[model samples]
Target: MSFFIRGRRRDVKEKKGKKRGLKNKQVLPVKKSKFDSGLDEEITSDEEEEYLKGKVNDIAEKEAEDVETAQEKKVRLAREYIQELRKERENEDDEELDDKAVAARLQEEVLESAGKLRRLVAETFLEPVSEDFIVLKSKHQKLPITCLTVTNDGKFIFSGSKDCSIVKYSIEGKRLGHIPGGRKGTENLHTGHTSHIYSLAVSSDGRFLASGDKGGIIHIWDGETLKHLKKFKSHRDAVSALAFRHSSHTLYSASYDRMVMVWDLDTMAFVEHLGGHQDAITGIDSLARESCITSGGRDQSVIVYVIAEDKQLRFVSPHESVDGVKLVDERTFVTFGQEGSLGIWTTLKKRPHHMIKRAHGCQAENGLPNWICSATTLVNTDLVASGSMDGHVRLWKITVDRGHRKLEPLFSIPIPGVVNALAFTSNGSHLIIGIGQEHKLGRWFKDKKAKNSIVVVSMKKNV
Candidate 1:
């Protein structure tokens, strides 16, 4: 098992070598929380040397103040390092706690929703999402915000709107500038299908931004300069969604044409395409270049595909539960759906660790399927939050134990109305909710002390 894990890690490193000259591979936010064992080991040896030096100071009373100052500085430095790690790890830990609370809430809601007899279900579960949070009302746009990106380092928020423009905002939600893909007010968008802004994916480092449009065009932007990096035409009919492979130059783009295409960001090349779905592909997540990918489509199926030995979509992943996935750890992950369906699965063997059905459905669909309205992954915490047409943003908690897995609905917070998209801050402490087909974009608090009122949202926060 360790070898398998090492092999995956090595694959990522090898791909970095392959990223030369192609599309610039972007750094993804680091998801692993355990302290670096190598660094810890190296620190042990250095600490011993430091202790020996301290012993020398102990024997030489000539410089007692200097020795005391050095000792104090060392200890203070160590504490500061630990605090930084904690800040980084806080989001991941919050996920664990959130999963616990959300799972319990979902258990009850699903039980109740199951009694409603609603079939084709798409239910979202969220918990005490602050009702008193602030919302930045877009004044000059027609399309609601459909997609958003926060730099891995948590510096900025880049939002894509149906208005055919990509807007960059500060981490707090302040609109800094806008990249017009085409006309802002008119429908003369540059998409091959039409001019609507479909979706957007910001690179982990927040240095690159990718947007998909209804016309099957993918635009890449320099996150800092807001300059156009490149434009790639899609083989799919209408580009609906796009995702960057974690820490790599490869990206996955899906479209209404029922195809998923993998692009080599460094080489500006099309690596492969996995086709067979009969409906439009709406949502996508890339775990790695060749390991696994999850996609949700209008066909009412959330499908998983395994990268083959030749680095192609192999169609080996499971399609049973079909819930949207949020990658928590290499061995643990969570999933959610519109029908009150959520599950936790392990890709180590493509099997579910935990499964729940009908968490938000009032009726049974007898088999006709539906699509989740909106879903977001806090890349740092691995928390899977999704909103449904049923007026809820559901959070799923995932527990990753070496070989054990636990996934449960952590909380079911209600939106004032239907939801279009869900996003959490880099710290996983705040949530920005875009109501589906609505004009309001709400900023909310996501903590244990979520009082009825969250912090006042200033459009300048861009969080």
Candidate 2:
């Protein structure tokens, strides 16, 4: 019985060994088939390639983010530094001082330190003798060009003429577009101005162009396209002057009816009307503030209207008739008259702070002062310019020392025509003058040598 059991165990061991050998043979052949087909190598190569591409994309994204962060940090630091400087300046001033006076002084100091403030440097500007000035003219209008306005960017100029036309021109005196004067009895037709165009204004944003005419009509146009958009007929008489408040669509228009009307170009409607002048309102001007300065012709009055408060400040002018007005800054303004005088005024004073009698000198034949028909200021600078029939455009520099302000003669450019309108570019690089044979408002005098055209004077000697 022991021999039989031993023999059975040997048989069982042999059967187990045979089963292990069969399993090993099956697994080895399956592995050899996968390697020979190249499927495993292909999958591994594809996964490696995808991993490298993802890594490269992540690196590029990180670098871009780092660069952007650096730029943002630099800008933030600059803004913070400027704010700190402003705060330090404000703290150094006495708190009891007038806020406007302190702000004005602080602004000048800040702008100067930042190198943003520019003045007519006597050395560079004075060397440009009258002959150095280059004058370019465009003769598209048949009649006198009454008013001229330059866009804030100094790229385009719009001029209104007595022929009931409005002409658009480039800075190089190239005519871009023209709106021909409509025929008589065409008042109802919205084609163009039926009467003479007396005043023109372009908004600071260069989005709206406004023109006032002798028929008490105000037309709004697309500043870039010169397409008429809307018409306003609120004034009862001829609209003489139009001004747009700086950096806004608010418009102030003066008319021969002795009324000043305010309009909102955004809503295309009238805001309100201001009345104070006893005679015709000849000129109007405004800055970034909510106020405007207007000159009353023949009434001998200069009125400042505060729109927000509905209040007006009236000052008596020494001139026979104030013909033109312009704002030098928010707190100060300048005006010219038919008596050939230029008056510098401030909102704080009832009388002119300084006056220059016979600014452009007198007429040779009549022995009377030449009429200063137009005047302009170089935005925020101390530069002022006046135009007349005196065959020259005079520039004045405002000197302020210890609260005392006065005008110092800078120089004059020879322009042989009746300068009915004067406009300065935003950068003070050019002066646009509308020249004509007759005066804008009347035929009081004629310049036989002058042509009915628009003249552009390059202010910079090298430009």
Candidate 3:
């Protein structure tokens, strides 16, 4: 198969301010007389070369236009299909012959149709050409927010940042002012990475606030007074994930050292290290009686662990290998980073019932960077979102299984930036996405054209 044909991909930027079909209109062909015998070989040769280039450019331009039109048509078709699906379930009964069979069949059908759209779109835009931001009620905080911890009541927010400080705010991102653990010395506030906070969590009662730092320390603070309650020197490695098990007075922290250690939140005492994974534990979440968690690294496998009766944690009955996993509910999860793959795994009864892989908006195969980060759930905790290294952020409608660890993606669309962190607003309407290179936050909504649409639709609406 060693054919000797040379190929190079060149990115063509759309000429700004040019209307559609303008390039084609400008490619008036050279007259036959121009290449006639009256002209010498050297005469007007440069002019002829320029004309030839213009002709080639014209052809390329038309081809690109056709590709763009086809892509738009594909997206329109997908929207129509989703609307039809919504309508199909409008009058349908849940107790037909087989609800499981019906859902599986419908999911398969949707996935097959989505797969057919892989050849439809051209992923050539660096920033989304159709990018738009629909503003929501954003809370402007005095201190830059490094990590967010939302209270169970959903009213109070606690933020930790590089200012070597922690502060409380409302849902709208307002500062509640210095608590006891507030950046004490005004002179030392900007001087140290002492508060180079990475993660934040709040107790269910909103009484306790906890923040973790790159210094390998986890600070437990009084939620109301903002005083340093207790600090745990838990791990030698950086504390990546930390959470409070509210119901049982337990605290959990995951580290780059590849272990999830359980602690007694009431006593602030170390409990046990849940250690079977071979890589860094990325995220941890707790469900009733069972704790769900994700551990992955360069090895590229995500394992879910649940605490056993003896207070030791073990992999859930079925060991599932996912590129990345984020649990939004006891039964639902989201997975990305593989197989034209945006997957939602539904594991209700100990098996993946519905698995949907949507290949609709992935980057082009030609020359685009195809790296996609892990999907994070925002907007009511049901919306799964992801951003590719190619600079497009995408959203997915997802459902997961609590028992079997299945994930299914119902719908998907693109966003902006390489999404490093995904966090939701107090209400599910807006999401704050951390961009990797930009280091700034961008907001994303469910709609494709959200600026004009959100303004018109949400002018009076609050969320």
- Between candidates 2 and 3, which one is better according to lDDT? 2
Tell me the TM-score of model 3: 0.51
lDDT of 2: 0.83
Cα error, candidate 1, residue 360 (Å): 3.2
lDDT of 1 by residue, 381-449 (tens): 446676654445666655556756565566666654445556666455566665435422232211222
lDDT, residue 272, candidate 1: 82
Which 10 consecutive residues of model 2 have the lowest summed lDDT? 120-129
Q: RMSD in Å for candidate 3, one decimal?
A: 30.9
Instruction: Go through the candidates in order and give the C-alpha RMSD of each one to the true structure.
Output: 21.6, 18.4, 30.9
Model 2, runs deviating above 4 Å: 1-124, 127-139, 461-463
Arranged by TM-score with the best first, the candidates are: 2, 1, 3
Stretches of candidate 1 off by over 4 Å are 1-132, 181-194, 276-278, 288-292, 296-308, 311-324, 348-351, 361-371, 379-382, 399-406, 438-463
**Tens digits of lDDT, candidate 2, 1-463:** 6999999999998798887776544434544665466445545778888977998999999997776776788788767755555565645466544445556765875664442454654324553455445454445587888999999999999988888888888897678988888877978864779888899999999999999998899999999998989989889999999999887999999999999999999999998899999999999998777889899989999898988898988889876888878987767789888889998887778888799999999988988998898999887678888999999889898887766678888888888889999998988778888888999988988888887887777776432
Q: Output the number of the TM-score-best candidate.
A: 2
Work out the TM-score per prediction: 0.57, 0.73, 0.51
- lDDT of model 2 at position 138: 49
